[model samples]
Target: MGESLFTKVWNMHKVKTLSSGQDQLFIGLHLIHEVTSPQAFAMLKERGVKVLHPERTFATVDHIVPTKNRQRPFQDELAEKMLAALESNTTDYKISFFNLSTAYQGIVHIIGPELGLTQPGMTIACGDSHTATHGAFGAIAFGIGTSQVRDILATQTMAMNKSKVRRINVSGKLQKGVYAKDVILKIIEVLGVKGGIGYAYEYGGEVIENFTMEERMTVCNMSIEGGARFGYINPDQKTFDYLKGRKFAPQGEAFNRAIRFWKSLASDPDTHYDDVVNIDVSDMAPMITWGIHPGHALEVSKSIPALNRFSVDEKATAQKALEHMQLKEGQSLLGQKISVAFIGSCTNGRISDLREAAQFIKGKKVHKDVFAFVVPGSVQVKKQAEEEGLDKIFEAAGFSWRGAGCSICLGMNDDQLVGDQVCASSSNRNYIGRQGSPTGRTLLMSPAMVAAAAVKGELVDLREVI
Candidate 1:
């Protein structure tokens, strides 16, 4: 029997088994951000400690940094303080910081890949929940809390139990108007939000293999939402092609040597898995989150499922999401009125995402009542979009093209929904208050779908809009 990538990586990183039966795993790359690391750094300061390996840790600011009007001394005093604390801590500790002034600064998850910091076979951890985004490169990545961030900072290791690996085989080519975001949303709906507890998802099959690096990131970015500890794809030529010449990736002969090691990390043909799931995406359509959670979703062309359709344990959340969203059980998400449209986030804020949206929305005017904006995932993405004239296309179509940061994704910055407004958003998660306003309703969809909604000012099938 062959070994799974999870087992191979776990065994390679395992320092020892602890009394609690959890393995003390070494962290290869530790990512830090403004929000979570401040307190952790404070704790380390109180203890009179320095980061164990400053070279392994990287820091940036995303959450709480205003994408627009980014002058210092932000209106949100708390956000300003977090930014200052991160700057001070990184400077004093001699850790690399991607401050706002640098072209490298962006969402931690986004910059990691674009900068080549995330690599195959590495154990990556970050303070943000979407750190699994790195696993798209075949790395073992975890989203940790503040204390765990401190642990990795001081010791370069954290205690964790090994997670059972599940092989997810997604086959079939996606139809036009459907995209990677739709594919992952459908998967989450099928698996249920909590279905992945104690498991690591290894994505494979024709659909995933054919997907671009950005698309893989879209799927892996949501693993945590499904209760999975980590989600990853096997590294292949496509993965190697994407990493080539990247800032932090190996170059020349070093690159050739690294590729050999990276290729060896892929699961062997007869690898064992705790469970397996097979999904077909050929006939799927654009998916929309009608309820609060990512799992509470349905095809844009389909009507919302009645409460009776939910499992017994899901009925309460189903009921609450309906009430909060003010949606009827049998109502169709199609033609639902939307007041805002957002196209950005670690999930769907890449250069490809922008190009696709810009191409579709060109020559179309946004609905008068809808306010729409696009924030690139990173400064480099922003520069590329501008060079390609994508920014002009967006602006002419009545969408605001703003600077890079998390923007409206987490509602930490200035951008957010107001009142009970309904929004068509490309960002992940639609939990109540996820976009700042507790009553604001977020309908999660693909970047192109969000562009379609912006044009019509309502939820519409991408096929019809296109």
Candidate 2:
């Protein structure tokens, strides 16, 4: 039997077997952001230890950044302090910091790939849970806690237990209105939230293979939602093409040499996996999450799962989700009114994502009762969208064109929904309180779907609008 990419990357990065039955694995790339790195850096200072491999690490500020007015001395004192700590730590340790003054500044996940720091056959770690976003490059990327971040900063290696590999194949073509975001939501819905507790998801098949690098990133970005520690697609021509001219990627003949190594890291045709799953998207519709968690999603035309339809194990959670969302079982989310619409996040804040939404909302107007906005994942993405006049499309349609950062996605920043607002969000999570307001309800959908919702002020099928 051939080896899976997960095993190959894990074995390559293994430093030594620890006494606790976890392998001490060397992290090839360490990404940091303002929110989580402050505590880790303070611990490093307390322990009198320097970063083990400052050269391999990079820092940026995204969370807690006020997208509307980014002037100095951030209105949120804590936000300003966190950003200052990150700047001081990165500068003192000689690690590269992409600050607001630089065009390269943006969300941590968005910059890593654009700069070519994330590549195939490597181990990447970050303090954010969505660090799995980097696994789109065929690397073993996973989120680390504060303590784990300290471990990587001090030793450049952390103890980890390997996961079983599950090959998931999504066959057939996506409909005109469906998108990568819809695909991932469908996967989580079918497998349930806890279906991937001990597995590394390997996505493949006709649909995934044909996906652009950005599309693959969108899919890999949400692996954690399905309980998978890691999710990835094998490196391919599309992967190499995307990385070729990236800022940190190799240049000239070195690029060819790197590709040779990257090509070797792809899984073999007969690679063995502990388990396999198959889903067909030929009939898949654009999906939206009607309940609290990501798994509570149903097709827009379908009604919410009634309590009677939920298993005994799920009844309590289903009931709680419905209650918090102020939604009734057996009610279709179609024509459900929304108060807000958000387009941006690590999951769908890339340039391609922006373009998709921009194209759909062009020459359209936002609903009179809805408040809508678009936030680029990074400054570079924001620049690219402006160059293509995407920002104008959004602004003309009554969507607020805001600066790059996490924005309303995780809601650590000033951008947040008001009380009891139902938001059509392009961000990953739909958990209650995820959008800052404890009473805010987030309806997870694609950027295009969010655009449609903003235009109509209700949950309408993309097919109908587009």
Candidate 3:
């Protein structure tokens, strides 16, 4: 019997099995951000500890970087403090950091893959929940907490219980307007939010196999929403192509040798999995989350689910999301007014996402009542979008082309929701108060969907707009 990719990576990185039965896994790459590392660094400082492998850790500022006007001594005092702390910590600890002024700087997840730091058969860790995004490269990636971050920094290894592999195969062809974002959303809807507990999801089949690296990242990025600590696609030709010319990737003859190893890291054809779930790609639609949780979603053409339709445990959660959103049950998601439209985040902030949105908004004007913006995931993505004229299309359509950062993805930055505004956002998470307003409503969808909504000034089917 052949080994799965998860097992291959896990066995290679496992240091030893602890008495508690957890494996002390050595992390090949550790990504960090300002929001989660401040306290962890402080803990290390107090304990007189030094990073065991500072070269393995990379840091960047994203969550709290002001998108509009990124001047030093930022308007937000707390954000300024966090930025200063990260700068000081990284400098003092001799860790590599992508500062705001660096062209490489952006969301931790976005920068890691773009630089080819994420590789097959690697154990990757980060403090953000969406760190699973790197799993698209066939690595075992998981989100670690602050304490674990400290442990990784101090010892280069962290203890973790093993996760069973659940192979999710999506076959058939995806219809027009149904994107990678929609595919993952449909999976979450079918499997429910907590379906993959204690499992590492392995995505395969025709649909996943045919997807581009960026598309795979979009799908793997949201595995956390499905209750999976990690999710991945087996490495293939597409993966090798994306990493070939990257800055951190090996060069020339060495690159060919690396590709050979990368190819070998793929799961064998007959690898066994603990469980298998199949999905039909033809049934997926352009999906959006109508409620607080990413799983509380419906197709743009569908109506909001009624409270009575939910289980008793889900009823309370649904009602709370409705109350915070100021929405009624069975309401039509179509034509629901939107105050803001955001097209950036670690989840959907790549150059590909910008191009997709620009294609739909090319000649159309944004609705007068809507405030829409396109914030790229990284400085590199921003430069490429400009080179491709996507930035012009967005700007001509009345969408503000802002600097890169986690703009409006969360409430930490200057970009925020005012009053009880309802935002159509491409960023992950639609949790209440996530967009800087306690009562602000967030409808999570793809970058293209957000652009379409901006033009219509409401929720509209992307198929019609496209």
Cα lDDT tens digits for candidate 1, 1-466: 9999889998999999999999999999999999889889999999998899999999988888887888988888989888999989999999999999999999999999999999999999998889999999999998999999999999999999999999999999888999989988998999989999999999999999999999999999999888897999999999999999999999999999999999999999999899999999888989999999999988898999878988899999999999999998988988899999999999999999998899899999999999999999999999999999999999999999998889888798889899999989999999999999988999999999999999998988998767
lDDT of 2 by residue, 118-233 (tens): 99998999998888888888999998899998999999999999999999999998998899999999999999889989999999999999999999999999999999989999
Q: Which pairs of residues clash in candidate 1, taking residues 3 or more apart in a chain or in different chains?
A: none
lDDT tens readout by residue for model 3, 112-214: 9999899887899999989889999988999999999999999999999889999999998887888899889888888878887899999999999999999
Stretches of candidate 3 off by over 4 Å are: none
Per-model TM against the reference: 0.99, 0.99, 0.98
Per-model root-mean-square deviation over C-alphas: 0.8, 0.8, 1.2
Q: Alpha-carbon error at 168 in model 1, in Å? A: 0.7
Error of 3 at 320 (Å): 2.2
True-structure lDDT of candidate 1: 0.93
In model 2, residue pairs whose N, Cα or C atoms come closer than 3 Å (at least 3 residues apart or on different chains), thus clashing, are none
Q: List candidate 2 stretches off by more than 4 Å.
A: none
Give the poorly placed runs of model 1, Cα more than 4 Å off: none
Model 2: lowest-lDDT 10 consecutive positions: 297-306
